[model samples]
Target: MNRFYDIINKIENNNNEITVSEYFHRCIAQAINENEKELVDWFCKIKNDVEGELVAWAEKHGQKYILGRNRAERKTWGIQVLLGKKIKYKDTVLNIYFPTEFHENSIIVEQCF
Candidate 1:
């Protein structure tokens, strides 16, 4: 089985005992602690793909945006910004950092590993 699926299954099976968030945190923390490159690389690729999708969406909608990485409070991750006048997408403003928590947590997790 793919390690990713294995991790998901493990999370699902124990969903009754812990919240999905907690399970995911534990899995990633363990993976990082053990220096699991395959899983880590998988996560990095997913992050990159997510950033790409966000950038593509911004461009498709005629928004001027920049994609790059930023470090704040000692956490680093890819970031995308919709520049110029404030643009509203549905109910929220688009001038916000993307994937703030996931990437930030991953940065914080790296230190524990």
Candidate 2:
């Protein structure tokens, strides 16, 4: 049986919206951890590079992406994230590091992986 599911579909959960590049990135990380050779081989056949996928995805959302840390996170631990549009709060302004969903008055992270 062809058990391998569509990588893009699997990464984009029902509640969370994910771009193709993000899916591929997470797939690579997971594939490496699991050492899934077949997965990698299949991925190679579909996309020649991740750059094109990223640029296209960014265009779709009308947002830009960067590799380094954001200004707010600069003086801190410098943990990397897929920084989105900047958001303003009642007390302060912060960048939308990632998509989120509301869960009964609580915020749940839409994990990339």
Candidate 3:
């Protein structure tokens, strides 16, 4: 029962699906508090590595990948089409689609892992 879990719960409550960055940051902080920094770091690193595959895939599809604070943000960027396609990287889950393109305001990816 620490503030880390509180923050994570708050994030989950705020959104139906948590973003990669949100998950990554929260778990990292929690791990440190629990003296499991290495474990959390390893978890996140694998998550990112898995995401990298999606990133490359998106690039080949021509649809831009946009990361945002909410679903609305993705809509604003016209990348809302890239949703629902969950990508699993080891134990982490990315609750969105990975596009295969990028422009100036193309994708706003969550940068945590």
Candidate 4:
């Protein structure tokens, strides 16, 4: 099997969801390796488009959006939220709530999506 197919298959079989940027970067890399300029360009364009949506969503909620660098130096999109901020998470018994207006230091990538 081709190495590119193998990589994609591995991603498909994984249980965890990948961020949009990660997915597109992988596609772009594979296209580059295969010398497919059109494929690479398409992935690059769509990656920007989708990531822009996430940024817009974060902005709409009055949250600060960021592209944070990981250990691998890759950029990941997320929103900054407070630790004691309001969130709607239900436990087995009931839903918990917090102060809607506050500030903290936590990056929530899931919230952006």
| Per-model TM values vs. the true structure | 0.34, 0.33, 0.43, 0.46
Best by TM-score: 4
**What clash pairs does model 4 have?**
none
**Tens digits of lDDT, candidate 1, 4-112:** 5445434332312332223335556656765877776655554454455546655665544423321111012322222322223122112223234345433211110
Instruction: Single out the weakest 10-residue window by summed lDDT for candidate 3.
Output: 72-81
Per-candidate local distance difference test: 0.37, 0.35, 0.40, 0.40
TM-score, cand. 4? 0.46
Residue 107 of model 4: what lDDT?
20
Tally clashes: model 4.
0
Candidates by TM-score, descending order: 4, 3, 1, 2
Pairs with steric clashes in candidate 2: none
Ranking by lDDT: 3, 4, 1, 2
lDDT digits (tens) for residues 1-113 of candidate 2 = 12233333344332223333444456565555668778676555433343443344445555555212111221121112234323231111121122123322221212221
- Candidate 3: residue pairs that collide: 58-99, 58-100, 59-100, 65-107, 66-107, 66-108, 67-108
lDDT of 3 at 82: 24
> All candidates: CA RMSD in angstroms?
14.3, 12.7, 13.5, 14.3
Candidate 3 lDDT, tens digit per residue, 10-63? 333223344454455555666667687554665477447535744654555443
